[model samples]
Target: MNLSVEKCPRCKAALEVKENPSCKAIVIKACPAGHYEKEFHPALETYIEINKVP
Candidate 1:
């Protein structure tokens, strides 16, 4: 079972993760209040904009 890293940052409310069986068990964490966080981000542009390999 994947655990949430922390409680809701906005309201500090309890969070729960639900799996969508129809969608191939996609995990979604949510709080009682309408608050959510972005857990994924692609850095393609960032990689092109900044070259760290020197």
Candidate 2:
């Protein structure tokens, strides 16, 4: 898990970061004021490459 601090893009407030309860690989970052939300997929590239069938 990346412990780096992140700021909200909309309001520039410090974001709250956490791992999704259902999926450990996904990281959730969101604004406390509901200005922004995002999910980080650490293995998305690997998953895409593995699923690309020729």
Candidate 3:
């Protein structure tokens, strides 16, 4: 799970991060009082192919 190392947006509470049941992306559950969750998708990072070298 890709948990955000940041505080909750609403109440400044600790965020709980977990992987989705069906997908590889992660879901963040935070602010128990507010009762909300957010989805976090990992960026598809890759290096591009180039003909010229630096």
Output the lDDT of residue 13, model 3. 68
lDDT value, residue 36 of candidate 2: 69
Evaluated against the true structure, the overall lDDT of model 2 is 0.64
Question: What lDDT tens digits, residue by residue, belong to model 2 across residues 1-54?
Answer: 455777666677787875577998877777777776767778773321111112
Instruction: Candidate 2: list runs displaced more than 4 Å.
Output: 1-4, 45-54
Of 2 and 3, the candidate ahead on lDDT is: 2
Q: Which scores better on TM-score, 2 or 3?
A: 2
Question: Cα lDDT of all candidates, in order?
Answer: 0.46, 0.64, 0.49
True-structure lDDT of candidate 1: 0.46
Per-candidate TM-scores read 0.44, 0.61, 0.42
Error of 3 at 39 (Å): 1.8
Query: By lDDT, who's the top model here?
Result: 2
- Candidate 3, residues 1-54: lDDT per residue as tens digits? 547565455566665665468876544444445444554545644322212112
The prediction achieving the highest TM-score against the true structure is 2
- Cα lDDT of model 1 by residue, 1-54, tens digit: 437465666677665665556654334466556564322113322211111121
